[model samples]
Target: MTVRVSRVRQHSVWASLVSDDAQALRGWLLQLGFAEDLLIPGERVDAIHHCQLDWPEGGRILLSSTGERPTPCRPGTASLHVVTADPDAVLARATSLDARVVREIVDQTDYPSRDFTVADPDGNHWTFATFAG
Candidate 1:
């Protein structure tokens, strides 16, 4: 019995963001990155909840205005980690957006990675990092 398992092709990942200030968050995201709407029609930042933004490469962020956190962690908890080519660029953008930097950008010897954490306008934390060899 030699059955090999193959990995499935992932189309996109949906990151849900529950926030009271969905409009502000959406504005920040739009300024940072993500297109208005290309694939779907009427997918703008009009609704209070169920709003989504398409990423340039792949994946989309689902912004909900339910004011209910999805994760089981604390209220202001964001463990979002994004691996990118240039972390400094992302940090610059985040800085321009006036995002609160929880963890300054630095090279971590323990994890062998360069990363930084920033808190969004709605209190969600986002971590952008680059893994090094």
Candidate 2:
């Protein structure tokens, strides 16, 4: 038996969040293996007006600094779940960054997923899971 994987060329939906310190958040995302796709600088050198970080597997995350503009989403209130082939590796990187562990790695037999959750410096919850669904 053989399995084939399909590549995703474009993503239709993206997760967006507001961060008190978008520059710092961008660095954190990079440490977690997200590639910087685009960055729009704000008035201040450290302020980020907008940024797009792409996950290697698929999908991307959009973020902007709080008070940079009026946004509906509030900072530190986002909960993002990302699917990855190697959750353990991602977890290790997150651990090295000293990110707060919200939930330890757990194997869910019913759904058949191995995942863990952590909190970014902005207090956003990020869950890395092997399950794509």
Candidate 3:
């Protein structure tokens, strides 16, 4: 089953980008109204709530983050989280595209979310999850 944004939004839904180039990445994200300070050089972002975006070329965007709840942009992030009712089906689709499954779908008793992870050809991380059923 194909998962949609609304499904994850039922609980706590959030997305972020952990990039190596936080400076250039932050600069690129700022153009779209992402918190420039949060992404600044040497900022203590580990615990802070920061918006992660894929928007480049600098444009206004609507993003969601704890710092800026209900962000100005839609639900879009460099790290993709796809909520699928049938995660196996979604995994098959990604596998067809040659996506690398880093983590197989399984129940995480410690965490509220049951999900798996994958890596795309570009090394972008994709997480597919669902609430424990």
Candidate 4:
């Protein structure tokens, strides 16, 4: 069964990503606590035309496979910042997945937030922080 995003929470903006391996990217996002909202198949059995992953806290991301169609955006070149209540938990999950830690978690007194950065298998940098802004 496919999961649906909650109507209570509406998102006006969404981050978009292109992936060479859409399935693997989806798995990675799922492992990191993103819920699969939608997945549309492409021309090929294994190709994904589009996907929507909803973050537990808030917001959503749209992802598409790098296929025959030309896209201005390239895979592994996007950097996304996600705000979460628990960055430590996210860090632990990232470590369990053996994702590369691009930046160690640090407390920024100026911004008064805790954040860390990790690179997914596709090389996209994901930064999880306590500060929403």
Residue lDDT tens for model 2, 29-105: 99999999999998877888889999999999998888787879998998988988899999999999999999999
Mind giving the per-residue lDDT tens digits that candidate 3 earns over 54-93?
3222222222232333333322235655555566666666
Worst 10-residue lDDT window for candidate 1 reads 38-47
Candidate 4 is scored at a TM of 0.88
Error of 2 at 114 (Å): 0.7
lDDT at position 72, candidate 1 = 42
Tens digits of per-residue lDDT for model 4, 6-89: 435345689888888988999999999999999898787678898999999999999888983567989999999998999999
CA lDDT of each prediction against the hidden true structure: 0.66, 0.89, 0.48, 0.88
Tell me the deviation in Å of residue 58 in model 3: 25
Arranged by TM-score, best first: 2, 4, 1, 3
Which ten contiguous residues of candidate 3 have the minimum total lDDT? 55-64
TM-score of each: 0.69, 0.89, 0.40, 0.88
Cand. 3 TM to true fold: 0.40
Evaluate model 1: give its TM-score. Answer: 0.69
Give the top-scoring candidate (lDDT).
2
Q: Positional deviation of 34 in candidate 1, in angstroms?
A: 2.8
How badly does each model clash, as a count of residue pairs? 0, 0, 5, 0
